[model samples]
Target: MDKVNRFIQFNDESVETRKLLLYERIAQALSNTPYMKVTERQLIEYQPKEATLAISVFWRHRTEEVTNLGRLSDIYLLSAGFYRQFDLTAWRTFTTDIKPHSYPKLARQLLMLLEEFRMMESIQKSRAGTQRAFKVRRDIYAEFHRDRLLSNAQRGFLADALINQLYLDIHIGMTSSPHDVFDRLPIDRVRQVAQRIFETETTSQSASLAFQIIALVEEFLTGDIVLPLYTFGEAFEDGKPMKQSSKAMESEEQGESDVKETIEEEFRTWHRETEEEKGMHLEFDLQHGTEGASDASDSKPGNEDAEVQSFGTGRSEGNEKEIGAQPEIEQQQDQSVEPTLQAGSDYGHAHTQVTFKVMEVANKTDTSSLSTLSAWRINHLPIVRALVTEMKKRLERKRQYKRENLTKGRLSSKLTTMLTDERPKPFYRKQAPSPELDAVFGLLVDGSASMIDKLAETKEAVVLFHDVLRELNVTHEIASYYEDTFEASKEQQPNFFEVMHSFDENRVDSGPAIMNFEAHEDNRDGFAIRWMANQLGNRPEHHKFLLVFSDGEPSAFGYDRNGIIDTAEAVWETEKRGISVVHLFLSSQQPTEDQRELFATMFGNKTASSDSVEEFASQTLRILRKLLAIAVQ
Candidate 1:
């Protein structure tokens, strides 16, 4: 049994993990079952038939028949699980009454396919998610069939039409057209007949209807007779029903019982042996070499004395090696500790602040020109909407806390007030101001010359982000920071930070300001982050987030080598003061090892990067979602 268990290998770890997660998502969709008990089921990748995608079976009988049906199989298994939760005794009886074996191979296959469609339709009526899963599976199958197996022939047309009709019937967004080959097939009529037959309220009527459909399809495919496949609701009359022998049934039961008992005995034996070994060790420890004296008569003569001497020699050698390696290990550990960033007196002289009035900045911005950039026109509205929805849900959850008030909630407070006469009138509980209502965001874009190529896409992302935040009514500030190339000197402040949008302005139309953003000079990331953090930290909002957009390493007049460390330290300090900082790396090229390490050091797990401009918005939203999840929790 153990050998057999070992031989039944599952799929790759990652593949199995994904399959399990998919199963969980589908199961959660069907959690509202009201009739038959729904037990949590495991999904194994197995092929019961050559064309079978997936099927459900008892856990104890799981097989290793592998299938390569991809995502379609996942949805099929999910749909099967959904249907299995309902009472299908009538459907099962109707199927069994047909005696599928009595029909031809094509008729049997058609029956099975029609049964699957019927079950799916029934499940879809109650479970909308099931309908979606069916549509996805149908689409996948359609693609595979059309691209690979479909041929321009009569049989191929029939097969394609059958699948196309199924897809059209289940998909809410799909419509029939004259261009479609399946348009000529009376799919609606076929569905109507199937539904009418299945819902006859009697097993005999339902079985008769199913047989009629099967015969009609058979006649359509093969020009032939119009006889029923089998007697409608009667058992097989021509052949004798086979029964299992009593002896065989008893032997099978005994075999299963024997296997169970054998497993139980093995566990007991292992446990008992473990206990005995522990007892022996305890006895030996208490004796402490006095075992020779206590059991002198039972001791083996010279061999026992030789074993003790050998054991002592081996222990001595092992102790010497351990003692010799200790210092080197300790030294290595000391060397591995990361050094902390230290601020020098000259650090404050590297960057100077630059502020601009909203009207002045807006006037200089060419919104129309910026909008014409190719990258700016990339459609990312879907991603923006999804992100906004996620953020709103988090905020809503935060605001839904129970609070104590004197208006309306529980009767207990009112009853207490009545009993104590604490107030002139009875007091009722009501919700108070939620602590999590306040949240502030800071958007910092690196205005270094290196970002010139990425500026268009970066601006687009910032604009979308600004729009989403404004829609959500979140307080946020957008700023661009760069060093002044003309003023850059060892003895003077060279860095300039430009404020495009401030929290106090509550501006929704910041598109002009975002468009005005242009690349200039070098970047002093640490100083800019520290300055941004200072502004965000002063806000009254409990949840403060500062997101930085940068291309690569920071390069300023005197802060190039130490800028990464400085930024990392600044991030740590900001987080220590209850401010969440995330870094978004926008680069058209793949990130180098050093680049990844620098960003990881500064942002930890709060960093996200996009190798292409198109993914910038999505990557930013992904990071935002993670940050919001932690902040809300």
Candidate 2:
């Protein structure tokens, strides 16, 4: 009681000013309610029917966030907008004008609930035409009442009191999906909502609840989803030197929880899987703690703390060159008016980049942190983390082993005297020049009808390429092609392409064979291979190249050998613009005369036919280093 009394009496803010602030907050909340009359004239005839879809989508995200925020009641009238309904005391205050002696908890709860609901909810289901439309009406009553009462109390209910909740919802509803309600709203709503939310929220996120709420909001609002390109900067066999986290990027993502426990669990699972596969070259095994290894100085000579710091995932900030330096492809329009990355220019290979873009249900600015969240949650992060960690550990092992030998005046097989300098150099491939395409590299894979037999094998090839390309600061775009040619042009260069007979993209299992769940003539590889080559042909930079696997379907980049039909000649014209074609003919049949001629011309060697994508990809990997070296050089 004294806490509340002391807070009000000593906090010298004027009551009248607070009252005005309260009205502003109520208006903000009311603005978010569907079908609310912005002007007095609209009130007479404006039926809120159109707002139903927005309201439904908004309510969906609202439901999830409120539940997680521990403020479900605020979004739901089930227990008076709380996960756990409050007592009559909460109602008494709202139904009557008299304020309670100490309802700080109620105010706080309402603030948290409303903040979560408003921020996360945007793409609401329309109740206007449905039987349950009345429920949204009920929600408006509860939400508006709570907001109004908090304002009338002449106090800032939550730190987010000044936030424009309506704008936040509008931002969350926008998407390319015709069903999304955000298309009707102005994009300014996203910016305005983000600003208000950012302003009203605490300067620092202090609690787990705050983090969760922030994460949820981010997941719901970031306006676009830019699929990450896996780079090669981090690629190396286990036991080789490890790159510093800052070298490649704010190493792509992880959470703040028991990361070690998660890591250990992955370790165990990895070992089990490898053991099951009878790993020929690699398998996980726990190392025992060696005695006398405590302080940094006491660390084994080669396994020094500096060599392989336990990589904790972080964002693109430490010495960040650029974070997603260029804008996304979908937003690219009127390029001459608005500058964009030139064809084959540095579009995805900046070693250090920091992107400020965020993602969410509706994809607004307020939910931007979710960009990092999604990045953190990416499966590649841990897989790559473990890969990098394992690489780091092996390097440390190799280092310590060499250090011991050096003390004894001996040498290990891993080290060889370098010609450049007298210093011992590890047996590793020379680092390639940065392709310098962008702050990120995008690998758009073609998975369509013709690419069917090669699909399974291409999986590893994609991951392997992803590992190297991402490490090298490159992003990729992989999609299918069947009959129809896929195209995405960024001022006459590849941006992101996906077209399987003109149907929309659905990532994996996308072609006629995969989607129809049946068979076909299987000549789709011609169009698929041609499309990939054409996409690569648009690039002006020689450094950026395309790695494609096909069955040699008599396809030309655009035309045969030298004709305009050959996009390859155009693609290959760049300084290092090479298309190192590798085909693992996943067909049991021997290469026919035409097929042999095609494969021989495209890939240097005739088809080495296989039945699956895995074996073919692995077989292809062995030759990749040489082919890539030649291409980039």
Candidate 3:
């Protein structure tokens, strides 16, 4: 394949991979059946009449397009319901006994619908959340079939009654319009049919039951059972005609060949009679030096000289002004329109380009230094453990108001009141620990040339950071950013933003990706931060933290002084959207007055600076504690 085709294929595979991974995580959390598994397949691969138990989702309906958490939750609930209740072996045996040739397609379809309704009801009884998801899905399905049902109703088709029965079954007790045709159906009869199907001992019996129900509905429709037929009068009121078109009077319909082009054109002379006369007069004056020419001879010589000099100077100034204005106009147009940046490619973004290269530390001794740092962190694990414990406590407190669970820590005030207010006995309950954390972290490292000297220390600090977060089971991503030196230009930004690690349950293996980080080219801090923020912003996490590791101000082509302002603005925008952005300065030397002011302007009080490589780990830990405190609070 060519480059374009290869790029498209890679993106398609990446999306599918991400979706499969997400599905696996959800299944692991919710599926109790040991053999249950879920995978993605193209919708076209599955036959319309196939009876296999699998979910068919289009590529466009991936989790990223919808609410990822909710979509995954719904998928899990559906999968779990199928796994728990759907006996594949029994279903296969039943299908074999009945045979596809013996079963009517309509009867099979009705059986499938009944099975889906039963599964949803069963799952909803155990999970209140699943109830909401099922309701949404049912409503969507009903809307999709609304037109077909209406058309069938107009034709007095018995299948319309069956579909309406399914709709009424799904929306059993929900409030609906009084005039709705489905509401007019015998709801109790529909319920009885559904209950009978649910009580079937086997899939074969269920199919037989479904066919009987269909026959009964057909007989009822053909017999005295009166379905309230929809009428045009119900939708529109009688009214007088407002206007009539000319075509309405035509007795014969117009054919395509009868149509003709309606456009007409006329041409007129350009010069008018008065304009031609004036042109002749001007020519006569130029040829014979007429009376009009003598009028200039009557002017004073001094006044004429002044006018001549003023005219010459104005022409010179006009030429110079035009010359100076051309570049400014082009610059204004350039600034007014920003080119779109295509992501997930090496040389994509108009202002930034990205490439993946193995990270190399200049000093071989730095590897030993990293080992030494790791040893120190191991010794200090007790302190880190204490910090983690405290942070979890705060998180638990924050989550208490939103959740109710049995706990031994305290008595339930409401329960106590109910039991002791009238009686002599009191009741007590304990709160359960929160099931999940509501935070996600994004670590953005500056990969500019200036970071080369501090690369080793940064790597060690990042590895330790990863370890700490892993222990806490926090969802996070680590990325590095720098300009692509060869492709960098003022007009086209070729900055590279590399993902060292992604947010995944299996984050323990991120050490290798992080270790591959190496400094490169220049840095565009604001653009890189915005890109990272976009990644974190779409996440369902309540508390988002984007930590930036850089030495000084952003430096890139056309980004020297304005880069600082842009970075500050990007930070403010991120924080305004409920994300916390913290800057970490990695210079070993003491920060100068200028550095302090610049850092303060970019990060306010959320900025932390390390004096040397030895203190990198300690400083990072301190900064993380501060960040966690703010997030938990």
* Most lDDT-accurate candidate: 3
Ranking by lDDT: 3, 1, 2
Whole-model Cα lDDT of every candidate shown, in order: 0.53, 0.31, 0.56
Tens-digit lDDT track of model 2 for 1-633: 001112454442211222222322332243333111111111111112111100111222245333222222222222112111222232233323213313322323333444344323221222122213233443543465445434532443222321223322323332222112223334343334333443333212212232333333333332321211111111111212222223212323333221112112222333333234221122245678756646676555554456664544434445433433334433332231222222221121110010111111111222443343344336445545554454345434444442322323434454534444465543433233333322212233443355555444454444454454344333343443322224422212122223221112212221222122211221223223444555555655444344444444422223221221122222223213455444455443444554444444434452355544445545544444444344333
> Which stretches of candidate 3 lie above 4 Å from their native place?
1-380, 393-432
Candidate 1 local lDDT, residue 13: 16
RMSD to the true structure for each prediction, in A, is 23.2, 31.3, 28.3
Candidate with the larger lDDT of 1 and 3: 3
Across 538-584, the per-residue lDDT of candidate 3 in tens digits comes to 99988899999888777777666345555766777689888999888
What lDDT is obtained when candidate 3 is compared to the true structure?
Answer: 0.56
Q: Cα lDDT for residue 119, model 1?
A: 54
Candidate 1 similarity to native, TM-score = 0.39
